[model samples]
Target: MSRIGKKAVPVPAGVTAEIAGQAVNVKGPKGALSFVVHDLVAVDQSAEGIAVKPRDETKLARSLWGMSRTMIANLVTGVSKGFERKLEINGVGYKAALNGKVLTLSLGYSHDVLFPVPEGIVIQVLGAKSDQIIVSGIDKQQVGQVAAEIREWRGPEPYKGKGVKYAEEKIFRKEGKKK
Candidate 1:
C-alpha cells in the first residue's frame, strides 16, 4: 500500500550490499555501514534492485514497510557518498576555530565555549572570518546530530537573527522596539 515501499532501491555501481538474515551491510567508496531490518518487513534483492515489503497485512507491518525501505536506501547513500552539514555564525565577535579535535566557539560570551569533536566525524572551520563550520561523516544521522549539537550552543534569535544557524536556513526577524 505504501508507494515508497513498493519502489525498488537500486544499488549504485560502486557499492556492495550483503544481506544476512535481517541485517544488511553495505560497503562503498566512502565507507561501510550496516542496519537491521524490523521483523515486520521483508527484504529481497533481485536483478532489478532491492525490494522491501510487509511480512503481513497488519497495520504495524504496513507501517514498517516504507520505513524499512527508506532505511536501506539511506544506508546505501551514506556508504557511497557520505554526508555533510554546514553552519554559519552571524553577529560581531561570533566565530569558530578548530584546534586538533576541539572546536572553540566565540558567540559574544565572555568565555569561549570548547566543544570536543566525536569519533567517525570531522569538523572543519572555514571562511576567512571563521564564520563557517562544516560537519561531515559517513553516517548521515551522525553528521546531522553533530551539526545540531554545535548549533544548539547558540541558536539564532528572532529579534537580531544573530547566532549559529544552518547555511541554508532563513530566520524570520521580529520587529524591534516600536518606540
Candidate 2:
C-alpha cells in the first residue's frame, strides 16, 4: 500500500473540490484547475476529504497511486494559495525588465533576449538593479517552466559563478588558472 495515497487530502476552507468520473475539479479564490486522473487509480471525495485507491493490486496501479493523489493535492493548493518561483541574475550589466507582457533580458549577449509572457503567468522585476525576477502563477508547472526558461538565457559558470540562477540555488565554484 502507498503511504501517501492512504492519507486523505483535506480541502481547505473557501476551496471546493468536485470529482467527476476520472477528473477532479478544484476551485478556490486564486483560480480553478482540473486534473484527469490515470485509469489505474480511482479518486473519490468524501466528508473526510479526497481519497485515492487502486482498482487492482498491480505494479502500475500501485506505482501511480501515490502520484495521482499528490497531483490532486497540488491542484487544490494551486487553486487556493498559488505558486511562485524566484530567479537571480549575476555578473555586471546583467539585468531584466518587464515591458507590458514581455520580459526583456540583458545577459551580456550581443543582442537582448525578448521573452513573451504567456497567459496565466506573471513576472516581476525586483531590486534597484533589476537583477532579481519573481515568477508567479496558479499553475505550478507553468511558473517553474517560465523560471527555467529565464535561467537558460545565461546559466551560472563554475569559474566566475556569474549568470542567472534560482534564489535558493547554489553554484559550485572552480579554481582559476595559476598563471
Candidate 3:
C-alpha cells in the first residue's frame, strides 16, 4: 500500500553497503553511517539494492515500512553526496564568522553570540558581508539540525524581515502601524 516502500533503494557505484541483522551500514566517499531497522519492518540487500517490507499487515508495520526504507535511502545518499543547509542573515551590522571551531554571530545584540560547531559538521560563512552561512555534513539530520540552531538565534521578523533565515525561505511581511 505504501508506494515508496514498494520501491527498492538503489546503491550507487563506489558505495559499499552491508546488512547485519537489523542494522544497515553504509560507507561511501563522503563518510560512513548506520541505522537499525524496526522489528516490524524487514530489510534486505540484493542486486537491485536494498529492499524493505512489512513483517505483518498490521497498521504499525505498514506505517514503519515506508519510513524504514526512506531512512536507509537517506543514509546511502548522505554518505555518498552528503547534505547542506544555507542561512542568510539580514539587518544592519548583522553578520556571521567562523573562528576555528566556533561561529561568531553579530545580530545587532549588545554582545556577539558564539556557537560552537559540533564534530562531523562544517559551518562556513560566505557572501560579501559574511551574511551567508553554509552548514554541511554527511548526516542529513545533523546538517539540518545545525542550520536550524543557527537560524533560531535571530529569526526573521514579519515586519522588516531582518534576522537569520534559510536562503530559500520567504518571510511574510506585515504592514506597519498607521496612526
TM of each candidate vs. truth? 0.96, 0.97, 0.99
Please give, for residues 1-179, the per-residue lDDT of candidate 2 as tens digits.
89999999999999999999999999999999999999989998999899999989999999999999999999988988999999999999999999999999999999999999999998999999999999999999899999999999899999998999999999999999996
lDDT tens digits by residue: candidate 1, 1-179: 99999999999999999889999899999889999999988888997678998989999999999988998999998888888999999999899999999999999888999999999899989998999999998888899999999999999999988999999999999998876
Q: For candidate 3, give the lDDT.
A: 0.95
> Higher-TM-score candidate among 1 and 2?
2
Over 4 Å off, model 2: none
Ranking by lDDT: 3, 2, 1
lDDT of each: 0.92, 0.94, 0.95
Error of 3 at 16 (Å): 0.7
Index of the highest-lDDT prediction:
3
| Clashes (N, CA, C under 3 Å) per candidate | 0, 0, 0
Q: Which stretches of candidate 1 lie over 4 Å from their true place?
A: none
**Between the candidate structures 1 and 2, which one is better when assessed by lDDT?**
2
Screening candidate 3 with a backbone cut-off below 3 angstroms (N, C-alpha, C), the clashing residue pairs are: none
